[model samples]
Target: MPTYAYRCRECTETFELNRPMSESSAPADCPEGHQDTVKLLTTVALTGSAIGPAASAPSGGCCGGGCCS
Candidate 1:
């Protein structure tokens, strides 16, 4: 299972959910019962004694997953 973050456009509330990868793109109902919600793009901070080249590299974009100018 993977965790997903969702933000409600109506109430502006944010939340998280644990679901299967196949349902990642599935729509989520906001806790406030708002239907206008979107899955937020999340990021990870890979900081530990054992770091990798990707984590050490400078952030390329907003999410640091590249795909940005």
Candidate 2:
């Protein structure tokens, strides 16, 4: 299953849904009686060394040894 983000053009509402790949692109109506909803891009969870800025950088000494012992 993948998580999809959706935006309702009629009601200007945003929501998320966990759906199968086959049905992930299906059009969905807003729960608030708005029918002009559109599916946004799907998102994936990142893990391990791909998490943040520090995780992406080398376990370094310093910038030109400025603050390094």
Candidate 3:
């Protein structure tokens, strides 16, 4: 349960809360019941595939010495 993003400075609503990160800094009441809230700074984007030996290409220019063929 983790989804917290709030912004409601008395009517400029924008909310979301599924809290449990220890309340995630509790204090949220938007959805038109503004409580002068402010707590939004989220960004998470991760895609698969990445683990051990598979990164070698940087010895020259244009294509690591292959001249961009």
Candidate 4:
């Protein structure tokens, strides 16, 4: 399940809902029983670096293989 963020225009309350992707566009009510809510655009923060031997491998070419020299 994915979490969707929403904001209620009536109460100006921000809330989150866990729902399916299909229902992400559906209308949501705030915790305070406000129906005037809009889904907020959220962003996922991804932080990581590639690992393993392939990550450290250098680019190979004719010069890298001593063919140009």
Candidate 5:
């Protein structure tokens, strides 16, 4: 199962759904009965140093012990 994010255009409401990949997206409606919803692109988080130090440090100050000095 994968989690997907959806946004309702009518009400500008956002919500998350967890379902099987085989399942098709439903026309999600807002609590107020608005019916303009669209599925959003799902984002997966990288784990275990896959992003590396450069991604962790935006200032580039900690590389090669520059920050410590």
Candidate 6:
């Protein structure tokens, strides 16, 4: 299952939901019973050495990666 982030336009509330990839575009309801919501773009975190395609990626920040230097 993949976690999807959504935001409610009515209440301006944000939340996450776990669903199958097939329903990735499915609308999510907010906790406040708001049906007008849209999915928000989310990022995944990878914990490992800079390898493969991510190797050429730039550093995120000072605390990013294993080294603080």
Can you write out model 3's per-residue Cα lDDT over 1-69, one digit (the tens) per residue?
Answer: 989888888777787889799989978888887688899898987899889989876778766676766
Best by lDDT: 1
Error of 5 at 21 (Å): 0.6
> Residue by residue across 1-69, what tens digits does model 5's lDDT show?
788788889778888777787764756666667778888987798677544445444554667557765
**Model 3 lDDT-worst window of ten:** 60-69
Candidate number that wins on lDDT, 2 or 6: 6
Q: How many backbone clashes does candidate 2 have?
A: 0
Error of 1 at 9 (Å): 0.4
Cα error of candidate 4 at position 67, Å = 9.6
TM-score of 6: 0.66
TM-score of 4: 0.72
Per-model TM-score on C-alpha atoms:
0.64, 0.58, 0.30, 0.72, 0.55, 0.66
Compute the lDDT of residue 40 as modeled in candidate 2: 80
lDDT of 2: 0.77
Quick one: RMSD of model 5?
9.0
Kindly list the per-residue Cα lDDT of model 2 for residues 1-69, writing each as its tens digit.
777888999778998877888997688778787878898865577776745555455455667554887
Q: State which candidate has the highest TM-score.
A: 4
Q: Please, what are the lDDT tens digits per residue for candidate 1 over residues 1-69?
A: 889999999999999999999999999999989899999999976776755654555667777876787
What TM-score does structure 3 among the candidates reach? 0.30
Error of 1 at 55 (Å): 18
Residue 45 of model 6 has an lDDT of 92
Shift of residue 25 alpha carbon in model 4, Å:
0.6
Better of 4 and 6 by TM-score: 4
In angstroms, give how far residue 11 of model 4 lies from its true place: 0.9
Model 1 C-alpha RMSD to native: 12.7
